[model samples]
Structure formats: structure tokens, C-alpha cells
Target: MENRVEFYRMSKTSNPKILNRITEQILKAGFSGNIKVYDLGLDDEASMSLIVEGTYENEDCCVAVGYGMNRQNLAIRKKWFRHAP
Candidate 1:
């Protein structure tokens, strides 16, 4: 099996509604297993990332959800990749 990854970005990070909707969509798309949320600090600002690692279309997959400034998101992405299995 091949490893797969998907990325999503949000402009409004402070809204819980949007975050919930995104999470719903992700789950509906077929990623089901362990869901983990991380709070990260980057360059003096708070950032967040959600990771869903499971099976998508019957194949192993990972989906990363992030919000906030582009630079911050980039940093979060790098951090996730650096520590991800």
C-alpha cells in the first residue's frame, strides 16, 4: 500500500463552527481511525493542527488540517511531518 496525505487550510482559525464543519467533511470522506489535535506555538504565535490517520478508500492515509497565517501553517506542516509516523 502507498502512503497518502491531504492538506486543508482555513482563513478563520478562531471560529469553532468552521473547524467542526471541516472535521465532519474529513470524516465523511473516508478517513476513520485515530484523530489527534495538536496545539503548537510557532514564532510567538499559537497555532493548531489536526491529524487523522486511518484508511481512505481502503488504503492507509493521513489528512492534516491547519489554520491561521500562511507562514504559521507552513511551520506547523513542517513540524507535523518531522514528527509523524
Candidate 2:
């Protein structure tokens, strides 16, 4: 998962089209369905986890997609998450 993020980031060297293609491939590996992209953030140093209020399969499939994005963000951009101005 994390590796995908790195690849996604590195893809900037190639082109946006290639990055989008790679993203599509990652999503297709899982069952096509609703996916919510969320951010894990902190408030005053308090930790909070993203909650998905719905049913999910235990196949590690959907989670894998999320794991890739989240893991990568945490690994490479832990301190650069978005903040409202």
C-alpha cells in the first residue's frame, strides 16, 4: 500500500496521465464500490482515527487500498497534511 503512494508520488516525474492510470489499477484490484477518502489528523496533539460507518469485507482488499494511501502519506508527508487557513 505505502509503496503505491511512493510510486504515485514518483510518477510526477513521468506524467499525470501515468499517475492516474496507476491509481485506477490500484482501485480496480478491489471490488468496485463506494470508497471514502479521509484524512487522519490531530487536534492539540490528540490522535484520532478515521471511521467508516458501514460494512466492509474482511478480505483485506478495501483496507489494502486505504492502507496504501494512508501508509504512504504517513511515511512521506506526515508533517505536510492539509490545514485550513
Task: Specify the highest-lDDT model's number.
Answer: 1
Local lDDT at 50 for model 2:
29
RMSD (Å) per prediction: 8.6, 12.3
Segments of candidate 1 deviating more than 4 angstroms: 1-12, 36-52, 63-85
lDDT of all predictions: 0.45, 0.31
Weakest ten-residue segment in model 2 by summed lDDT? 73-82
List the candidates' TM-scores in order. 0.38, 0.26
User: How well is each residue in 1-85 modelled by candidate 1, as lDDT tens digits?
Assistant: 4333333343325467645654565566555555443333222244445555556556555445454433323221322222444
